[model samples]
Target: MKRYQAVRGGTGDLTKPDVNTRVQDNLYLAVNSKWQKDAVIPADRTEIGVNTAIDMRIEKRMMSDLDKMVSDNKVPAIKNLDKAVTLYKIAKDFAKRNKDGAAPIQADLKKLDALKDFAALNQDANELDEVYGLPFGFEVEADMKNTKVHVLEFAGPGTFLPDTTSYKQEDASKLLAILQKQTVKLLTMAGMSEEKAEKYVAAGLKFDQKLAKVVKSTEEWSDYPATYNPYSLSDFLAKIKSFAMRDFLKELLPALPDKVIVMEPRFLDHFEKLINPDNFDEIKGWMVIKFINGLSSSLSQEFREAGFPFSQALSGQGELIPQERHAYYVANGVFDEVLGIYYGKKYFGEEAKADVTDMIKKMINVYEDRIQNNDWLSENTKKKAIVKLRALVLKIGYPEKEKKIYDLLQVDPAKSLYENEKALSKITTKYAIDKLTKPVDRSVWLMPGNMNNACYDPQRNDITFPAGILQAPFYDLHQSRGQNYGGIGATIAHEISHAFDNNGAKFDEFGNMKNWWTDADFKEFNKRTQAAIDIYDGLSYGPSKLNGKQVVAENIADLGGLTCAIQANKVDKGSMKELFENYARSWAQKQRPEAIKTEIAVDVHAPQPTRVNIPSQCQDEFYETFDVKPSDGMWLDPEKRVRIW
Candidate 1:
């Protein structure tokens, strides 16, 4: 111990192993030690061995039970098929009862025939292949029939409670009749013949009736609750706290959390001076605005360089852009360049230009009204909201100009794919460098005008509906206002609700990062939001579980959008039940398991089943429309249900 030793490089006694030798020796010792440890343990050890044995025995018992059930059944793989048959039978009966005209029913019959063919094909597949290869085949075939049933249920007499007195069951029928009459009146007012109006009404009635039958059939297979589970309350509260805590922590820690970070010092400097010091708690607020500006510029450059036709990129192609950044560009005038290209003399000709301008003006009016009338917002915030709404410069159809960013990079059609990629990289880098010194340009479009989606920008506090989404299923001049509102109106409501969602709530009407809520008001808002979190957390879907905390913001938007759309329809004297049903129908979809798994991890929106079922539980209109009872599968406890507007 008294002897001096050099720890870094000097060797010790010859009896000891060297560093590398010692490492090898230690590894060997570890292997031998593990073996000895295992050898010392008895095979019959009660603690670990008994538990595993018990688990295996229980699993065996369950498997045996399942095997018995499968063997006893004549059609072991036919549960979905049986459900489809039952739905088809219900549709046939409904058709018979409402046989004013048979065209729609005949169409349903054709669908049933197709289902039968698919089922037969499934039956012929081997058990091994069926189990592993075709698990989704049955569901895919059944969904076709289910969708039809869903549509039918919306149009018919609807449902009634056998014992309770709420609204008259006949009121729904009376409403439908009135709707038919008014539709005819409106058509006649728009200049259709009496005979043509009658024919149109007949066709419309038939379509609604069939649609209701389809809806009912689909609903039959759904796992909606008859009543809210009291046991779920504890779980719901826990979930709300977890989600809120996580998001709150995320927001507080970074102070400037966003998808992309742009480190442009000049813009950051300008932003810092522009924002009032009292408004921002930290310097990070300025960082966010500058980053967003850079992001918008980057996206605009990318779109411009792609050299794709304007309509193909913006409207028809359905290309997904980074949503957060795209929202910012749409709010600013940055989208004008692309719009000019498509709306000019070369595209759509000049006749449609005036119509396009009128549509844009109407859209702006709707945005302005929404911003001004939001009750939860304070007056100071409302003025800012109004300013932002007014400042949203409209860019209809296509941009009025184009950028030459792509000219920096030459693309040869004959070049190899790798060569083209290198050229693109160079172009992107050059474009980014070019933006470093330029003043922020608001007249750029992040997405093409022809795109089929819409968005709300928290920074700019503006909303945009691209030209692509302006077509069928969203907007159709030939369709009734009820249909158009249910389709496009719901979409508008969805975008507007985003303005108040968790992240969006941080931005003021002027697109500045700030808290505009009073302490009391913020507390109240959190309490209500927590209630929703708890409700959604208890939900189960198939084999996977829902991440309640992750989906709270989007869920809030969904519920709010539905509520807003229903209110809007009521103001227009439209059927509230129809509006609710249509909202549900818009979300009717199917997906592969792999795709669903990916969505769960990355997508902010909840899974399809939860999207449809959870929001419906919050709406009194839905409960009344569908005759849902406290004992029904989809009921929510009165005290536990959350409503925030």
Candidate 2:
């Protein structure tokens, strides 16, 4: 349900397909075939599509504005934008960067190497968090059951590959080899001998193999709301072996918490063997590579070249994006909200926000009708669903004010880029720690206004529609109402539908995880959910097959959103043909094979072709719009269609 804000790999063929393709056979190809044939994917980009096109246009405009602001000494009066400009200057200053090649991270590398045993590592826990994301997973977030307060979240560190399942692939050895080669190159540049670097990377990988066996996979993580398994603070500490988690928690948090959430109980059940005296060397090696790998991008150009292989392997890009573009991305990542506000203030209109807000409400009204008429849900369940829909807080364009931490984050001109990044991380770490006792602040937006994306945060019970996504294909005042309905209208419904999606269904209207469905109604809902899964399971994607269960949440949302969009359009007698064509047109894309393989393996959403074609066929209006016959290749059985809102 998210549109990426980057030039990601996509769904169309790399080679040209027949432009004379019939709409009944493949609607996506028929509507967007010619455009796909002519469009050239940039050398640095793995794929090209409508979302990437919109993202490129927005990023270009923002980069140009940033340059002008810096050159003319005319930064806007927006809060903390001056800090962004300062960081932007730091990122763009390659002369200083080239001069200070690798020196900035050398000290940090020494610090990591200094940890020889459990005592030293345990003693340096706070610094470990401030510098590197710790070897074991640690996060402070608002508890799912109690959204008003924060809790300490613990889990095993993530595996090197996309998921633990990837480690089981036959080509796993080859992929691990590529990562090893790059890590060795990076460590050697960090003043280690080639032999030592290779040994360290190999040892690190061995540890990774062990860790992967204990951690959760992407599919398991998809059911995220069920991650809340709280234990009393003392009982939680008793589970760990040889790690002074109690003392570590005390050093970082405001006070000793009453409870902590353990995300993966199985991971902790094996925590003793993972981090002990006998395995110190292997653990240290893993730590060395992880720290250097995390901060290598902001290091010297040598480090960037050394580190490019793993990234290039994931995305089949010929070369990196230009340095200026990289600089903007890095700086913007740090000051996202500050620059988002600037973009929205200059480019977004108040009238458009009001109009889109009205559009969202109307779409919700249609969804409400569907819920009321739903056969599976009883009246009790429908009432709760309606309350949740009505309570969905809308973050239309951007927030009126920024988070307080931005005012406190200052860029030190004398420090290196890596050092400045570390400094910012420290400030943010302190900020999050300070919020442990404070009430959760839902006013802080999840995505920046300059991002070409939208999301539904189940924990906060809200949906965000950024100004950047309000462009040609998704939304615009000039587009006809029918076109908009096909584009952003379906998209709006898509995000709203997430409130009732697989994971979100566990949470109540106030964003607490509680069962609100009757036993039989929930059983019926699961049956429909399986129907959505059956629609996509075992389907062939390029060089891969789709996993129905892995993608069922998004597929369910897609069907529900498209269904709601179709019903809403019929109310106004909108052109069904126009809606269907634009819906396919919006998902038009061309993807590289390497990118497609990775996407199918890890990405939650189906390929763009699947998104457009599969969901469209399920809707009855689609058959009427294009005169789809039973003999057509794309014609699907009515019994296979699923609409679970």
Candidate 3:
């Protein structure tokens, strides 16, 4: 403790404590106040905090290596990695791109222009799905219930606002207005007259406004298990009156399956009206505008600059990312797995990987003990929970096997970036369609190793800690064990806790959606989950308030992760104070107000401060370490604190 005080904290990307602030009153503020003062939201970024700081570093290292590969025109024997280089050159060739302007997409744009009516749309649906990327929404994934075979899932097309709830707000009109202006400008840039562009924009807005009314709200979407509504193939096809749905499916899928999982039953309820003759003009316009906006970056620099304000308003990003960074990110998205493998091999260390794997085991062990002793659950439920805990696959660092899709990628250097992306989209679409009857490969990772994040996929019943997150603030070999545990240990525990969260609880040990809980225990569990919701509900952050129901699962995980980490610390002796401080510090963030509003509207996670303070207040160990008083700002009355693991 004296050594930490003597240092007065490190500089640049490290959280510096504010000595004047008392830990008893505000843990996040006390830890983040000085760092917040020093932190600047980069011109091209909407936020910069703990995660982004690490992300920027990782990006720098990865991009620098990639930059060298491009410069030297060299690549290792890594299979199909040269395709990424091919794409990088294509995307990075701005001189050719600027000269080509919007010429490459003109013929593609003409396809939308030629859509005269519903019949035309039906004929083109498969081609659009291939080239344009699922115009509405349809995905192939491992069945939530079956957990082995892949299933077809069709969902709603949300509006320009993205979040359906935003349409309810009076302030949403301002955002819509921004969209309207940008859409018109982009259309005009694509060689449409101002009058024609206005007509197109108006029609698109009309469709979007109605679509927003019918689509699910962000809160409703937060319930992962409820989305698994299966419809008989015949029954599903009958819902679509106009668009020759039968032929479209036959072309899109390798074989017409027995079922179609309707992800948005409500959206499907109004499907015919939304996609029919009366609304054909509006629907077509919506498709056109969305296609243009989505691929605007693949066009000239002028087109990208034209679409900036709407992006700026939505995320409060001050300026566009440089073309070099933009090119790298675009290429990176397509070849991330390949790059992730290379990145893990080059940047990630074997020692760190082994250490993190051990920490993950400690967290899982603690969870097993917690479940065995959980007062709320019956023994029957306890036994089932332990089975799931033990079965939870830990994918640390990177995957040993690469995805089969990479084997098929053949990027052509002669083609335009837009053309390459379009061709690749079709290839990706075919790969996904081919998976309908195939068994779910549980070994395949949901997240790549290069991302500075971690995830738990309930369907696969696995947790992945990518190599990108195994660094400072999250994990560092040089940092104190308390800091390491509080940083990545809590994160590991967070992913474990997700297995028992409101959504994950619906799935059983085998990753199948089934109720393993006794009726009474399930009820009690929900009561506690509701309590978790109530605490965060309507809590203010900037101009928006959190929807407790929307963020309940993550909040539960945050609390549970903290609880398990605290217990793990009890077994391994460490500074409880440093654990508490670093736990608070890990969530240190600075976000733009616009970004916060957007996050509140759609994201399942609560604001950063909420992640820190709420979980800290819920922990008894936090009180002991900080000497929190009833009078302290961070203090919560014992009864008001929530806990469930």
Candidate 4:
């Protein structure tokens, strides 16, 4: 143990400890403190830890390849590669952007200015989508109840504030002050006088504040059924009597659907009332602000500098990100799949994908055993659970065939960045419109392989582990089975467990919104889930308490994931001590105080410290491995432990 600790950087060993302040009450700190203390958060970043390190490693590799592409004199033959290279080169040309200034978005501003009244505004709104700064968000998504068909989804406008809860924070005034300053700066850069800019900024803020009032808290949106308000096109027109809903829909979606799903009807109702001619000036100003802000990063240095302080106010970032790194981000966003295909071919090998596939099968086997052995659930529910587990779709690494939807995408080097953005947006819209009438493609991946994240889609009954997350820290091909199982194995389990979590449990094996639970079984399940929520509800980070109900789905997954990993560990060669330590290492992270503040307001996942420690206390194996006595801070009464998997 001593030799391994020395060789592996001694994360879990507690015999000889380093102390800045004595908070070493649990295994998480004992395992992670030294590293966290020694680590430096970058000047441009709010926080830096395990996940950030892995993301930076991926970024470095991608940037290196992109730089090489830029320097190469040979003309690119592949259409997709050429498109990606063109976008990257455009992003890198800061001199052109500086010269163009706000001219690129001037046409958009002119459209807003030309609106004489609400009638003209509504006409423009119908033609404009969210990317074009429409007052409301509009999109087509598969209906949750009827997963086979897509429906138009309308919701309230997004707030500039990080979360709806931010409006109620003590720092709300300070944050808004920063927002106002930046808005004025951008408007002035767009050729408005200082006096006019201030007036516009005030009007925009008033408009946004009113919209924010009707916006549901992030917690409230968790109840899927609550947000699922479906109405016939005529019913919507009558309900929202203030507006020409039919005409708007006809213009926005030329082939208008008979039915539309209003995610939050109350918000829509308020928006309908707020959009009267009386609110024209404020509404127009707000639209202009939204348009310019969206293009701020792609515009001049003045806009970028103006936006930086507001960003710092939100996330505690001290410096702006380097221009090259910003270009990489833009390039990835513009040509995700093209870059993803290249990234997968260059870095993600077939051997690694196969290894992950094998690991997934083993993890599923463990879940099958648990469901079969569960005494609380009925045989009927147990059978359904096992079926769901077996039927779960696993998408490792990247998609088999990268779609060539962007073949017709034309990015002109002579064009401004905002012009390119508008061009790209139109292409994406056409693609989405094309998909609206088609059957749901279960094989399609929602995220690219180069993004360092994994997710489970309950609508599709599938889990995806992107190639970016399949590498070191998360999974090390050269590391011990203990480490791999503890890291990526737990992540896979987290996603799989989501299929049975509070949210995922609502759907059946085929991704239909049908419950397979009997009344008695469902009652028992809710009791268990509520207990888990209670545990998290009592936990706090900084000045904000966790919205336990909001985060319950994720909390359930975290605990169930740890349980699944522990079972998988039994088949591998490692002590409970080594396994638990590796598990702790997987979640190792630190945050700026401000970042923690925002996370408490917005994030669905529990803070990282809570993620590492809470699940450990619930495990009997953890108590046994660490010899956690009743007096230990990590101790949880066996009866109090909430195990929901």
Candidate 5:
């Protein structure tokens, strides 16, 4: 049997490589592969490609469920509509009580009405389908079933071709030009003499060159490192204290009446702690440089306050629910039910408990082993990697402690939607302000626990997996291990890889922004990355082209994680062919046209099919598993395959 099974069934002999092949062949034969394949190919009359099948089904299912809810319960058109209206009423009442003037509150009421109208328009699922180009469901169904086979094929053994692109050189030049132009403009706006503006721009460019040099000298940082011990609480406190002080001044210095105060809080907060500030003079100089670089004024307060300590709330918070209950809710979406049967227990039972533990353990072990065995990284860097790896703290389920600010705000049962929005905004801003002057709180999770996603925070050097993503199709106890590992395990690898991607590499083991690579190493890293980007850029999706520069960081992580997961499977004696297929299946999803448009505009990840096809091209294993020749649709020239990590 494959090391990872999708559904619990009979185990296969682990001793033979052909065991996976036999399993896949039998599974394909059992399902009548030819018929399944034919079902996915849409008729000429259909608008969407067969590739869109699963997305369409998900959309249809959601729409049907929503319709039933509205009909049976007469639910509001929008989720939480009643709550929004009530908040607006309360804001208005509060305004009246305080005699602080009701004009602003009345204006908010108008916005609510607009929001309600928008919500009403969106209530029709068919309308949503029209707005978002929907992928066909048949396509997804056809692909998802055979994911294990495809993933293994995708990551099979092969040498990676060295990429020789100088794409970063071009990008660096463009960035330099923009900075030069912006610097001059800012100097002129601040009423500097023409000669001084020119000098300032020249000086800024020179400084940028220095900064780039520092970055270039630290290429080894690009390699993934093992986990480390958590930074001491005292160390975290000291760092935040210094960062807060520097951030505050970065905001205050340029606020003088005669000078242009271009320093925005967001930019300042982002860069203030990132740059070293050992001496007061050096710190002031950095602030001046930022002011000349066109920082906005509106972000000052936000930057200063963002340093708030929230981690203190994490400890001593008693468990919200039993472990079994938490696991059951994650897997089956039932509070105390098994399959269809109800249980007297408050949460999940024994079955769920075992599943969650097993999955988490597998993911962590894979990551630890990969970091230890990585060949591209230096031994010194490996030690630091281990520190970061060991320091990783996983937060599952919901936040142990919820922010208490929401309770202070008043809500009325009746009011317009706009008023409620304003009240909510006020509450959020108040919470932001409350964070100022606090100690660095490591426990504050950037994403809520239930969000259907995972992320790696370079600031804290931690990877997070939310509860919302730990369910069926992604991870399920009932599914075979091959399916679960290929699905959720791939995602876990992706997030772990992010810690070593381009931008994340800027931080050191202690999560401080520091350079720790040799110059020669940095050059090789950039050369390799640019090559990867070029390959991705060549990929076409209809009329649009992939933004190689913008997507380079994420693409690197995708490739690395895919690479690591495949390698881990091999170490465990799993079939490489099954792993590749399962990897592809993990990304199997359909999309609405509206959603596709939105994704193209802002999403960092490639669209579903491209996510599978493009990466597969770089993996030699994929071609071998599918018996793909040079003429195959997904084939790339052997020389063109870029291997960065």
Candidate 6:
């Protein structure tokens, strides 16, 4: 306690804390008030936290390494690191890029202009994405029913706004105006007159509005069952009358399968309606906007500046990120594994990997025990749960089968950044297409080690802990087990619990979308899930409230994760105070009020303050540890508190 106090800037007013401020009552504020008081969210950022801080640190290191790779002639010495350096060097040439203006994408724009009909558009879709990238996406993901094979999937076009619900906002007119102004500016820079640009913006706005009606909102899509509709090619064609589904797939698919997954059937239905000859002008306008927005960072200073205000309005960022930093991020996106391998080799040591791996094993053990002891589930259900838990794949630190996607990458420093990115996109597309014929590789990892986030892929039944997230605030080799358990332990548990969350629970041990639970057991599960939803639905941050129905799966995972971690701590012989305090400290964050509003509306995860306080308040152990009573601001009624694992 003394050590924690000393490290956290000594004790301050524990006895005479502000009651009205609600700081005394909240565990998060009590643990992190000293740091929170001084924390500042960067002007270019929406929010700032331990995660972001660590990412910035890693970015600086990557930038330095890139500089060395380019200037110090270290590229040839390393095996795969040169590809990242090559991409970085090409993008880093700001002067040449600014001078080139929109010339690099001019040929691509000409191709779009020459598209005479829908047939031409279909034929060019794959090629066009390689140049400007597509808002409409296609993928071959693991089949939900038959998990052994990859299935062709079609999804709706990506929105310019943060989410589909943004189109229906009461203040939507204001957002539309911002989009109009930005679109006009971008088109004008792309050689269109201001008058003509306004016309395009009008068409684009109407097109998106029509599409928004049928497109699923982020909240709606979170329901796995809602997006799981499947159809045969003939059946899919019959559902829509406006377009030839078979003809469209001729160019898009190498060999059209009899069966295809319709992720958003409503969107596809409306998209067919929206794709007539009369709508080409509107489609062209939307395509132009997407093209310009996608490559804005790699364009001239004017083009980049033109897109900033709209981005700022969307995300509530005060200023655009620095050009060098922006280029670094672009390199990371294009050459993910190249940078990941370098990052892991440089920053993540063997000791850290070993420690994290051991921690993961412990958490998995705890979850198996949890499932075995759970009273609500039937014996058969529990046995199936244990089977799935045991089969859970763990990928800690980095991938064992090295990702060598950069072998074909060739970037010339003298070429424009847009040209280099376009070239890389073609190679990436080819790589994705190559996977269509291959068997499902269970060892494949979805996330890069350089990313400061963890993920659980229900289809793969796997959890990934990237090297970037394996450090500080989350884990420390020298720190006490209590602190480590509270930091990374909760994160590990959260992801594991995701396997049992609303969406993930649909998939069984073999990663097939088969229910392992009995009808009665599933009914009980729904009741508990509904209770959780009701609790989160009522939570408010100032005037803004949470859409608990949208974020229930994540919230359930959060509670389950924290509970599992706390239980694991009990087994590991750790202090509750240390574990609980560190848990609060891990979620310590601050954001702009505007950012808070955006997050509450669009983000699947709860706001930082909500994340820290809500989980602790719901736990009985939290109350016991802190001696919290009904009179305290953070206290909840015993029956109101919801729990599920």
Best model per lDDT: 3
Which ten residues in a row are the worst by lDDT in model 6? 1-10
Q: For all the candidates, what are their Cα RMSDs to the real structure?
A: 34.1, 4.2, 4.1, 4.2, 19.1, 4.4
Return the TM-score for candidate 1, rounded to 2 decimals: 0.44
Q: Whose lDDT is higher: candidate 1's or candidate 2's?
A: 2
- Model 5 Cα displacement at 472 (Å)? 2.4
RMSD of candidate 2 to the true fold? 4.2
lDDT of 3 by residue, 104-185 (tens): 9899887777779877777778877665543367789988888888999999876688598888887788988998899888
lDDT of 4 by residue, 415-486 (tens): 887788788878877777666677777778877878889999988889999898998777978877878877
Evaluate model 6: give its lDDT: 0.77
Clash count, predicted structure 5: 70
Q: What residue runs in model 6 are displaced by over 4 Å at the alpha carbon?
A: 1-24, 76-78, 114-135, 240-244
Once model 1 is optimally superposed onto the true structure by TM-score, how far is the C-alpha of residue 345 displaced, in angstroms?
Answer: 9.9
User: Model 1: how far is 297 from its true place, Å?
Assistant: 27
**Model 3, position 293: C-alpha lDDT score:** 89
Query: What ranges in model 5 sit over 4 Å off?
Result: 1-361, 571-575, 591-598, 637-639
How high is the CA lDDT of each candidate model?
0.40, 0.83, 0.84, 0.78, 0.42, 0.77
TM-score of each: 0.44, 0.96, 0.96, 0.94, 0.51, 0.93
Question: Tens-digit lDDT track for model 5 on 1-645?
Answer: 223332111122211112223222222211222333334323211223223443344323333433344346543433242232233223223334333322323332232213222223223322222222111000000011121111000000100000111113333354345445554544444445567556545644444443332221112222322111123323322443333322332332222111111112222223323333333233222223344331211112221122111110111112232222222222222111111111112123456545655555666666667667766767666666666666666655444454444345444445332343334545544454344333345565656443456788776667766554566566666765555655666777777677667766656655655666556655667788888667666455433345665566778777776666666556556676656666655554433332343344344666554555455556676567666554333456667776654
Residue runs of model 3 more than 4 Å from their true location after superposition: 1-20, 133-135
What candidate 1 gets wrong by more than 4 Å, as runs, is 1-398, 402-409
